[model samples]
Target: MSYVSSVFQRIKVRNANEPEFLQAVEEVFKSLEPVLEKHPEYISANILERITEPERQIIFRVSWVDDQGVLQINRGFRIQFNGALGPYKGGLRFHPSVYIGIIKFLGFEQIFKNALTGLPIGSGKGGSDFDPKGKSDGEVMRFCQSFMTELYRHIGPDVDVPAGDIGVGGREIGYLYGQYRRIKGVFENGVLTGKGLSYGGSLVRTQATGYGLIYFVDEMLKHNNKVLQGKTVVISGSGNVAIYACQKATALGAKVIAMSDSNGYIYDENGIDLPLVRQLKEVERKRIRSYLNFHPEAQYIEGCKNIWSIKCDIALPCATQNDISLENAKTLVANGVIAVGEGANMPCTNEAINYFLENKILLAPAKAANAGGVATSALEMSQNSMRYYWTFEEIETKLKNIMVTIHSNAAAASSEYGFGYNLVAGANIAGFKKVADAMMAQGNY
Candidate 1:
């Protein structure tokens, strides 16, 4: 084991509260065990421990008035993990599922994900427990303004930047940015991302995660002597990532037959209707099962995991962590699933990941495969800094190029490290080397 790993094992035993954070860190280190052992300098610099811990964690209370004039309070957090490359960069999630553990896990993953983008952006994550799902527009706005009331004090154009995640979307960003501007009294456009097009949002930011996933999968298919020209695809999650993934995959000539949500999924043999689905999801804010009402040909299943068992040539798990298990991995492989690209953080558990690796299935970890979202966020920051916005074509072209470079770099790192086509190893080693070298150059902080 590497000396840094040895040090981490000791710290992990003493810090039991940070299980999610530790798990995220462990996965990255597991693939880099050999590299760390071969390079003692990284251990001497304690890069492992430093990378595991955040540079700062801000936990505060978000108190706001509801539409009924009642006061509601929730916890908010911003875990600025690392800034070796640039300012802290990541999304701010607003869901009932959010907490310190979830934020820490996401923030830790952001460190390497941002690094993979080859951009000068660092890693950070923040959010609150205020659920916007059932709340009214006025209620949502009040809560977002309160969340930003405290969050704005910590973030700036060149400091920690937050974007949209889960319940935090264009509407939430609008409210948050409004409050930040109201308080700061300046149009700090870059401090928050996923903004409306009228403001500073990039053209393709909404589609980056899904499009990037396909781009990485396209590269993987090329390596396997295949293509997405007419492949059957199954995607999990009906949120921004999964919906856009379906859109991009369909646009690229693939037939996406199935998609899932937190409740269940729908399978359409005639290929999912992207326009209809987007209308239902983005405009209507409805569930996947509701798609059947408009299209009687579609079938809705109650359980979400059933989507994984559906036969497909490509499987993209664009949902939450550990959503894909060992059994699901085996099922996909047995069903001739050639590739699996993660669009979520740690979507596959370690066992599930090892199953894909052992079976020689082409796999792209979330950090590398889904770096497009944050990379585009960094692009938004650039536009904000320069006081100019990029055209739709310009932003999309940049996102595609970044995803392609990330795929190639990860492949090259895997080949150089004797793992050949093992992208997990490649992504970990390549990202680690950049951060590790930076840490080494800066000396112990």
Candidate 2:
């Protein structure tokens, strides 16, 4: 068997129950065959094996009191996967679906995604099984305090820095940072990235991921002699990523017709109202179905998956992992989706990705496409370290340049390996080679 296959087989056996992690490992390993062939020393040195396993995995029980004064227990996890280039850097997700396997998968993906940013950050991911939905401010704050009470010890400014993911956002970050400050008794702004603006948060950080996804997609279209103007875009999820993707895509002249939440989706044939979406999701924290109250002319779908069936020129899966299955891919292709840019990690399943590739749909993989969040997080880290801040224009300009460069790097790697714009393999190879080289140079830890 080839070295890539051998390493994957071992990972499969060891992580048999961790289907998500195994899937992530398999996806990354499939593109690494060429690298393994080029550098035999990597296999001999067991770099792949070492990189597959995390440096530390912390699982602890978080007990906090809800508004009812009853003690509730939730399991929290932190997977400090790799720190070869610099300190461990990633996000913390808080949701009911969070588990060790999920955390491991996210952390594993982060290793490559962070490398693709061309930054000096490593990979890590953490989260809890506690669902933040419907939780009061006091309850959420208490839970965050409990979560940070344990996480603060394992992280530092120059050590492991975490931002926000699915369930964790600006509010959660503030609570976690506040707790960390209270516990440490020192002001360490660099310990976290998604802080409030008054307390050293970076501008454009909230819109970074969504804006970056569109920027990368714009680059992809440019490569094909196309542009975002007049394109009908359908984006899944109405959270930070989806909302901002809609905002940016609209500013770029695309008509975003649909966006969703866990409950359902809203379709506005005249183009989604970005302000109303921001109000419903960010301010009111209401379901997407509520969008109909304002835009009565728009259609509301009862199921989120059916949002894929809506015909559009572009599809951005900004929701959760494995949302686009084989059937969904078939529906999208049948409806003539010209391009797909994943705003969420591993949103497309392996079968779905194969269908898209076979149908010749232009795809921007998550690592390269949705890397704007972490890339901006890294920029935030730089500003925090210097005790300085950049204006929105300055930060956004840097972000655009970075996204363009990432596209070029991925395209170059694909062409070099004869993939010819196969960004999946391109991003994997490009990201893995950097981490592999760094690992080799550092020797065994």
Candidate 3:
């Protein structure tokens, strides 16, 4: 434990201002103590030190013209954290909150998330501090073009592959992929995972994360001698992940009663209308409050956090990081939340996570729980490489198998490490072993 604590102390000193990054390192490092105790070679080889550092970091200026013919500037980053297992693979988030700490934290978490999928992808993440919310189509395209102009040099089909996240969706991916094609002048469809279907995109890529989450939760419930059917669910975030999770949970016989956006949440005692949610958030791009216009019986609250207070059999935090604070954790526990599957990266705070684990609440950590998006992206990469397409049923089957396997591996790891069903440690440890072995076999750089 001294070595782990010492390495973390140095990380704290070196990355003093990078709290997000430090939190990521601390979380994984805590899980690694048992691994280190069992395998002394890992400690002697300084794997912890090297694994924590990114393989490459790129920050560039993105300048584009706005609708008013004004010059806009934004900062972009691509942290190629590691590529030992395979090419660097992760998402590019476009939001005002993106910074080095956020990108690094996400990239570090991506290492384990990708590994837990039992895929060949390494880990990386990219994004810009640009708010693309109100931007016109032309403006968004210009921004994406500008962002890709510099990013293209560092990525390729067998290199770093960036997918969509947060503010970057099909619209953003299409723009980015178009820009990459324009600059490269080649059909490197494998370079990007979230492309349009006509251009080597997978069928279920959009719904993969959300659907995969439910599948993983199903496995977990089955393992625990329970069933997802007849369960009441509450999910935060009305984005792609949340909407799809709600849809999948409903399809699997669970009633998703509440869902939220940043502005507020909607509670429908009779279970949420998934089609209506998709219409409002996806097609119409309206807020969750707009749900009330369609169904007057449903309640709409003003804040996103209060959605956790509603009693539910399960909670899925599909929103942003640290969304479930200690207070929210207490509320969920009090209201009898039996399990929580994180559909977002680091959705729960450390304190909140500790509370859940200590209370013996079934918890699915984000890295393991929300890895479906990237896993399906890797599948898309395989399809692109083979110049073939898979049917929706075929892809869904693959995704289900992968999720079930991930749950099995994580549970086994937790049991082996004396953590029982503590999936947080299990996922981190399982993922770390794969990448650590790869790093060791490849030798130090």
Candidate 4:
């Protein structure tokens, strides 16, 4: 192998414990192989290693009192990976699956995702092992308050900005921001994003990720002189991202035939009723199987993986990481999928990604495609700083523009490297150049 490849292999060996993080770095490096060979300065700087490792990692205890007056504690973490562009910005996830490895991987991906937004935001990710799934509202509030009690000390307007991820949403943000406000009495709106509308949340913050996923896919289609109109689509995960993706697909004249949750997937050969989906998932907090009760024509499969076999023109994996594997990807390609936009972080495996790329499918990586969430969070921060709230239409328009700009930037980057229409190369080269230039200016750290 060449020297650049050798350096990456060494770094991968040294950081073998973080499979997801290594997978992310490998994808970018493979796409940048040509550039690395041309620029010996990059190899000499060892920029890849510096860029991969977080500058600061903070892990703390979050002990809270439940409604039973029982005491519980969970681990919380914040990995500030890089700040070459601006202040550290990312989401805080609260789920049982969280750990140091997951946090680091998310943080590393956030670095490039934020960079693609073309917004002045850095990279970080944090959250707790505090599962809010079955807890009472009171219990969740107490846990969020307790979690933010310590987190508030570490975050501020200029220091680090945290938003919502997996298990953290409007409810969690409300509790956390309330506690932060009560403790500091400053009412700094930019400190936390994904807040309630009245409390300074951006109008489209809730819809950004899913809508942006569609926007990116639309761009991918347009790149090939195609569009989403009259296309059949299948989306995994019926949470915020999945629900919104369904809505946007319908709005774009695409028939979203299927949507799934952790338990299973619901397929309606006819277009999915996003309104009913919102009722089942958002208001009722139930599984996707229940949707069959409303629409008997819809079929419910008992596993998420089965959704991939459904024939479709486009697919958006908006669920958790590694939800799609080689087997599923092969099935998708065989079924004639033209494009995929990842709404969830690292939703597909390395093998699956290569399969898609090699097949000439339009693959929009999570860092470049699903950046709508963080980009809207940054907008929320701006609104918070100004103590002003924007209308839903206004925020939605701005969000659309941001996604279009990101698509243009990635496309331009791909063309610059003579890898026209290759989004992976575009994102890696564009994101890496920004962070590397900043690090060079800062000297070290």
Estimate the TM-score of every prediction: 0.97, 0.99, 0.99, 0.97
| Model 1 deviation from the true structure expressed as Cα RMSD, one decimal place | 1.3
lDDT by residue (tens digit), candidate 1, 30-126? 7776787678787777788888778999999999888788999899999998989889999998888888988989988888899999999888998
Per-residue error for 136 in candidate 4, Å, reads 0.7
Summarize candidate 3's per-residue lDDT along 38-57 as a digit string, tens digits: 99999988999899899999
Q: Could you tell me the TM-score of candidate 3?
A: 0.99
Tens-digit per-residue lDDT, 97-172, candidate 4 = 8988899889988888898888889998999988998899999999888888889888887889999999998989
Candidate 3: misplaced stretches above 4 Å? Answer: none
- Backbone clash pairs for candidate 1 read none
Candidate 2, residues 282-377, lDDT tens digits: the string is 999999889899989999989898899999999999999998999999999999999999999999998899899899999999999999999999
For residue 427, give model 3's deviation from the true position in Å.
0.4
**Count of backbone clashes for each model?**
0, 0, 0, 0
What are the runs in model 4 whose C-alpha is more than 4 Å off?
Answer: none
RMSD of 4: 1.4
